[model samples]
Target: MHETKMKPTINITRLQSTFDVSSSIGTTEKGGLTRLALTKEDVKIRDVFVEWLEEAGLAVKIDDLGNIYGRREGKKKEAGAVMIGSHLDTLPKGGRFDGILGVLSSLEVIRTLNDLNIETDRPIEIVNFTNEEGERFTPPMQGSGVITGNYDKEIIYKLKDKDGISFEQSLIDSGYLGDIKNRSSNVDYFIETHIEQGPFLEENQKDIGIVQGVKGTKRHRVQIKGKSSHSAFPNSHRKEALLAASEIVLTIDEVAKQFEDLSTSIGVFDVTPSVESITTEFVEFTFDARHIDNAIKDQAIRLIKEKINEVSIKRKVEIDFEETWDANGTYFSKEIMKSIEEAVESNGYSHQYITAPALHDAKFMTDITKTAMIFCPSKDGLSHCEEEYTSIEDIEKVTNVLLRTVISLANQN
Candidate 1:
């Protein structure tokens, strides 16, 4: 046990050792993790997690989506559990602490409780949500969505990876697929602690972030069509799709700049007949927009659409714009937020209210139960890459706050 500010705290040494062990499972050459969902590496990590949970005296189970759960019984088992969770799967190349820290920290919380022989009035459950990165799956946050009835289980089961392996098959291969009845629906409150994944906390010199909500995201695909021409074609006679697509990309940046908090990008762009000498006739790109307010996000999307049409007319090209996904902003539980704030205050750590730029499983959990999140600062605001880093001192601060918050929520009358 480590003592900080005259308060008993979790064993940071154990937490770091566990993190190092977990990081080695899908280790990339650059020290990043590539533990894709339900892959062999992911399964190995899952096995280790289950083993740790059992060792900690938690009753462990898995849901149909391979979302793993470990429950520590409290005095009253009938009451809804206070749940702490996050994902473990990473991108093809992702930072070490992006998704893994939340799980390890929650596990340490349980270990600390056991060390002190403390019992609350309600049970506590720690979860490892599957496919939160959605690298193999098309959409992310599959496990929590299925358990919450946000996504259709059958459809998710049939979803395939680039290697053509189905999700159900992967679950079977992993041996982690349990019954749907094992899903968590009786959670009284949910809290997830993750890395900030942005520069906000570090730039502000804050130790942690008390997330108020997650930003709304809208995904769309657009195609612009024009006449392909020879390399020798006259510039005035050419109506090229590539130029139109580039203009629309600029419009996305322009529209995003109009709103102080909005972020927009074109992550994917493709041009037909991509030859150096020939002008492309067709172009396609993905349009992604995000904002704290759903209506404002939609407003920006509409403005971009208008700009796309303008580009079409000016370039004399045809445009087809279609929205593929939409997720509205979600606010967390105020009571739980207060608990987290108080815990931060008790720990004497600096923090501020933040609207998460990226979404998490906690965002989906908000629909079924009261959900809140804590964010530790990411060095240089980098994540989903090998460059991401966070210090042990910051992790300790956030974990202690989480421990305090969980104890407070679990014992609440």
Candidate 2:
């Protein structure tokens, strides 16, 4: 067993102050935030992080992708570092503690270690990954995706927002376009602390959640084309794209219900020339599906495709399905997971092994290193909105667990 000379303590007051500082940058009317990646608000938060890190005497570095790293050197410089972090960007009007909590909690862990003057064999790093929300970008997890070789830097740089501004331009505008290499292949382990974003923990009365894995997600765009006609015309032989789209949506819901532990939804449904007098000529909708099992997820996709085809043929409308994004389910490292469990047990916190239904940067980090996550309860299971919240008491509990786990990993051989 790795021995500790002194037990570290997390400063809840300091943590709250840090949250106040970051949340102030993108305050919304509804008390949420809108700090999109690479935006001015995001840059302000990054600058604050750099200041805090430097004040703690940790060496700070920013990569080309604008990933901020605060490193605490160890006795063994050759040993791989234990990387811990989450993204800082939030969805539009997003809650203050979704991804931001993870990053700030990791900083708290580092701060606690510093206060104790604790040194481990392996270096410890707190990373603030850029664009984990991907609200502006098409796909999320861009920062970790780049580091894991899932995305090319050139392509990511060219990605444009709704405003037609390129990602490169935004980074440059924010003054965070660093020259440091974006890739880190030598990460010994990775851990992220985040809000549960669901009601499971709160409902179960657990203080901590040791996340076992993340569910896979598949996003697709479905377009239906049909002839336009006057609404007053006879409806018997008319091809209506909107009608076909409605049928497809119902079919998707039915198919999702057929499988256990599956989620499917059509978040966006658009009809062209949306006038009450004209029959719909074209319709487009986005399909999002997720499942913990790959086989189940694939089966659901197949069923949806078959249903769409059937609907198209019956409605006499041409349909096209375009796959927009896909990410397979990821399981965390067994060793790291065990360490977290141990930390929870040692800290006398009630915890349960859980799976993350929403996508996270830790899913991508698994590609390059052993990764795991710690989750605290969110009130009412609300996230990505202004109502999302987790009590400060819960935050403090999880932060302690995270600190213990980090200490354990840093001292490991």
Which candidate number would show the highest lDDT if scored against the true structure?
A: 1
lDDT of every predicted structure (CA atoms) = 0.91, 0.89
Estimate, for each residue in 24-62, the C-alpha lDDT of model 1 and write its tens digit: 999999999999999999999999999999999999989
TM-score of 2: 0.95
Q: Residue-wise lDDT of candidate 2 within 304-395, one digit each (tens)?
A: 89988899889999999998878898899999999999888887899999989899999989988999999999999999999999999999
Error of 1 at 133 (Å): 0.8
What's each prediction's clash count?
Answer: 0, 0
Per-prediction TM-score to the true structure, in the order listed: 0.97, 0.95
RMSD in order of candidates = 2.0, 1.8
Which has the greatest TM-score?
1
Indicate the residue-level lDDT of 350 in model 2: 98
Backbone collision tally, model 2:
0
